[model samples]
Target: MAIIRPARPSDAEELSTVEHAAYANYVDHAGVRPEPMTEDFSPLIGDERVWVAEHEGAVMGLLVLTTRPDHLLLDSIAVSPDAQGMGIGRRLLEFVEEHARAHGLGEVRLYTDEAMTSNIDYYLRRGFVETRRAVDQGRRRVFFTKHLG
Candidate 1:
């Protein structure tokens, strides 16, 4: 069974590990680590808006939603490689969408590499539409938005 709930500080290390593994390729390709792939979760998980998906007593995935009154930012979403393809990512995303709506946010924003065609397709299938593209620190990224309102 899998359960989604607010992330606790105790889960920080595991979340950080998962974040690193999930974004390692992107980080290397981009020549920089995205904020989400940082070494510590203190800045994010400590913010009180992040959530995790626990399966069989271990956290398999996580989603961090940062709000700015009018919009929601999917600052990060990651699933353990061992747990990928099991729908953990999808569940975490759904949780984010629901949480955004509950907070009265009109939309959710996120970004992924333009080079990651698979990721783009996955987001599109999940209702996120590309809004724009930009080069951030030498990395080509596509911004996406999913309306929650």
Candidate 2:
């Protein structure tokens, strides 16, 4: 099983490396580097919002969440290429919803580059609904929201 916890400053370097590797395969598909790939995790790790997923001492994925007045924002999620098939991504998302509800939030929201087709399908299958589309940071984005009761 993978363990998920708040990120520590020391985990920043490996988190950044894991993020880069996770998004490397999507550059060609997006025609540009995805935002997460270039993010500096060192600073983000200090924010209480960053979470890490690991197995046997090796970081395998990360979740960056931002809290809003009405909902939790799923800023970014990445699972290293080598760890993709083991369900870490799904588990991290599950953690997001659970975290949101525990904090008295009603929903979770996220946006992804529209070119990431598999991501679109995956989110839909996971119970998120498409709320809108827009271009952000020069990339076309599909936004999604999941309402929790």
Candidate 3:
């Protein structure tokens, strides 16, 4: 079974490891490092904006969320490469939605690299609708939003 919990400052190194392992594939395809790969999660952890999915005391996946005025931003979701097929990503996403609902947020929003068609399809299948596409930080991104009401 997997346990989802808030991240701590001590988890910084492990979360960074997981983030890198999970997003390494995108570096080659995007011709640059994915945004998540370049982030310093230590501060986020301290702010309680991060969560981890652990199984048997091992970190399997993680989600980073930012609370906004009207909605929560699903900043990043990453499952360790070794744990990819175990439903960790789906569970983490569900957790994010529940967290949003609990916080009285009306919606959740996320963006993915335009090149990651599989990820875009996954979000759409989960009821997220495409809101727009734009170039941000030199990368073409596809944005999606899911209304919680």
Candidate 4:
């Protein structure tokens, strides 16, 4: 099992590698690379908004979350292609909800490129409902939110 925890600055490079692999398959589908693939993780790590799943000292997945006044925003989530089928992405999504509850937030919201159909289905199956769809940053995005008790 992988352990989830705050990401350290030293994990930046490894995090980028994981991000790249995780989104590589979506390049052709999205017609552009996923944003996280070229993002710099050190800043997020320093601000403590990033978390990592570690298995045997290797970063298997990462999550970036932002707390809003009424809900938590799941900025991004990715699991290394090498670590697929290990449930890391699911665990990270679960952590987003747990974090929201712990912070007394009522919901968790996230958006994905509309081209990522698999992600839309994944979130829908996990109880997230589509809130809307529109163009953002020149890409069509589908937004979803899950309300908590």
Clashes of each: 0, 0, 0, 0
lDDT of 1 at 49: 69
Candidate 4's residue-wise lDDT over 1-149, tens digit each? 88899999999999998899899999987889987787889899989999999988899999999998999999999999888899888888888888999999989999999999999999999999999999999889999999997
Residue 130 Cα positional deviation in candidate 2, in Å, after optimal superposition: 0.5
Reference-based lDDT, residue 93, model 1: 86
lDDT against the true structure, per candidate, is: 0.83, 0.92, 0.92, 0.92
- Residue-level lDDT of model 2, residues 1-149, one tens digit each, is 79999999989999989999988878988778999988888777777889999988899999999999999999999998889899999999999999999989999999999999999999999999999999887889999999997
Native-to-model Cα distance after best TM-score fit, residue 11 in candidate 2, in Å: 0.7
Root-mean-square deviation of Cα positions for candidate 4 versus the true structure, in angstroms: 0.8
Give the lDDT of residue 133 in candidate 1.
Answer: 96
Instruction: Report the CA-based lDDT of candidate 1 relative to the real structure.
Output: 0.83
TM-score of each predicted structure versus truth: 0.88, 0.97, 0.97, 0.97
Question: How does candidate 2 score on lDDT?
Answer: 0.92
Clashing pairs for predicted structure model 2, backbone only: none
Candidate 2 displacement at residue 2 in angstroms: 0.3
The regions of model 1 sitting more than 4 angstroms off are 27-35
Tens-place lDDT digits, model 1, residues 1-149: 56899889899899888888877777666666766776467666677867889999998888887888778898778988889888899888888888888888879899987866778899999999999999886778899998875
